[model samples]
Target: MHGPASSGWLLVALCAVTGAYCLARMRSGAEGQRSAAGGEALMGFGMAAMAVPAAVFTPPSWAWPVYAAVFGAAGVHALWAARAGAHHLHHLVGAAAMVYMSLVMAGSPAHAHGRGGSGVPLLTGALLLYFAGYVLLTGVRLVPVAAVAGGGGPAGWGDRPELARACRLSMGIAMVAMLLTL
Candidate 1:
């Protein structure tokens, strides 16, 4: 594993901070919509942490299931909370992509599948592109809102809505990095 010396610690810290922030946001009388957006941001951070290091470290086979579980749970949660067409589509594709990656890792010839190939890499790249496109679209939709508000708007540039947009960007970047590694 060629991961950073503090990769594990960094992951833990990111998760904790995001988790705490979400909890605080929820407890602050935030609406379900806002909380859901915050949750997406937290999930994005988690995904970024996992995907980035996993690409670099290429952890052992057993780690695949762990990745699947983490990503699967997040995807499911996002899907459950998704109301808009774009959000639903994003979660659906993300869930499928994570599942595909998990299966590929589990069935690697080294894990005894024998029918080895680079299909997983190609599929992952496609998924990453899809995700990146989705994020770009969503981010574009958010820009006018962020710009018009300029800090004093109903949902400020740094508000939950913007946070969700930021998360999409981070997830898109992480997916791209993961695809490149593949």
Candidate 2:
């Protein structure tokens, strides 16, 4: 994203598309599914917020502290929500990562696309590596190895469990990529 305008725009598209998919799922899903989808949508929204063209404008420094606080609260909520299922716990970790990234950025400018060099904090680097592995594993799982297994028409975004998981992993990748800019 630090390269050309196209790279930034591509990331924006990825975030927007993922957010839209989550919103659509929340709208069409049943009550139980709706809650999880809603959380996913919220995370998608947060990712989109971070993916915006940083060159255009960055939020004020004060905003970053508020962001950190909000994500911190969300992380706690996610932990409580985890009683429903393991996915919620994953959301909890994601929210915590958001809080950490927010606090890190808050200490600096609201928008800094500084990548490279040894300044990468240990925690941030570890998180980045973890998400990178997740994205890779998810992508591998999505490979088309079941052409004749389903034996049906194309499925909706939410119809396939693997697809949903892939979406979540992609969002994680997006979040980590965005954090690398801080």
Candidate 3:
């Protein structure tokens, strides 16, 4: 049973690590391949962290700034790396969802406990569905290519397959978690 304060710290740590990883990977090469993959993984982890606490425990007032900065950065990065694939859209949507939730949490007076409202759940559910569907679609597309090749295919999946898989699985888990909360 993670309390709101503890959850907020968890989110902060997740975002910080992810942000650092993204920056490091971004500077690694000029092609932006590794950086894009790192960004995708980091975004997945960040989304999972944010979704868990946002769905389980209402965040504190002070946490909103962190959430905003992290998610806003992610959104910008996703848009910047839009050529990666459809997964970029997932990042974009996830970032938008986080920003919206952070704003809502920041404005709410009842930040100590959960917001006992139907609207939050509804919005969360929608965001979860969007990300989950995006993940599933991307996964489905990649699995076949992997299968047809009998191993790592010649497509984009062969290049950074693990990161692609992670993006799909993380988003799927996040979606399930969010739906369970609802």
Q: By TM-score, who's the top model here?
A: 2
Per-prediction backbone clash count: 0, 0, 0
After the best TM-score superposition of candidate 3, give how far the Cα of residue 138 lies from its true spot, in angstroms.
3.2
Measured by TM-score, how close is model 1 to the native structure? 0.59
RMSD in order of candidates: 5.5, 3.8, 6.2
Give lDDT tens digits, candidate 2, residues 95-131.
Answer: 8887887776666543444533468778778888877
Ranking by TM-score: 2, 1, 3
TM-score of each model, paired residue for residue = 0.59, 0.79, 0.57
Clashing pairs in 2: none
Candidate 3 lDDT by residue in tens digits, 99-161: 776665576554233366545466766776676776676677666553222245343332444
> For residues 1-182, what per-residue lDDT tens digits would candidate 1 score against the true structure?
12343554454455445545544445433454454545555554555444444443555778768767877776777677666445655665666666566666555533232234535456666786787777678678767754223246464323465654555565555555444443
| Candidate 3 clashing pairs, residues 3+ apart or interchain | none
Judging by lDDT, tell me the better candidate of 2 and 3.
2
- Per-candidate Cα lDDT values, in order, are 0.54, 0.70, 0.56
Q: Which runs in model 2 stand beyond 4 Å of their true positions?
A: 1-5, 29-32, 110-117, 144-158
Ten residues in sequence with the least summed lDDT for candidate 1:
109-118
Segments in model 1 whose C-alpha atoms lie over 4 Å from true places:
1-28, 38-42, 52-60, 77-86, 107-122, 147-160
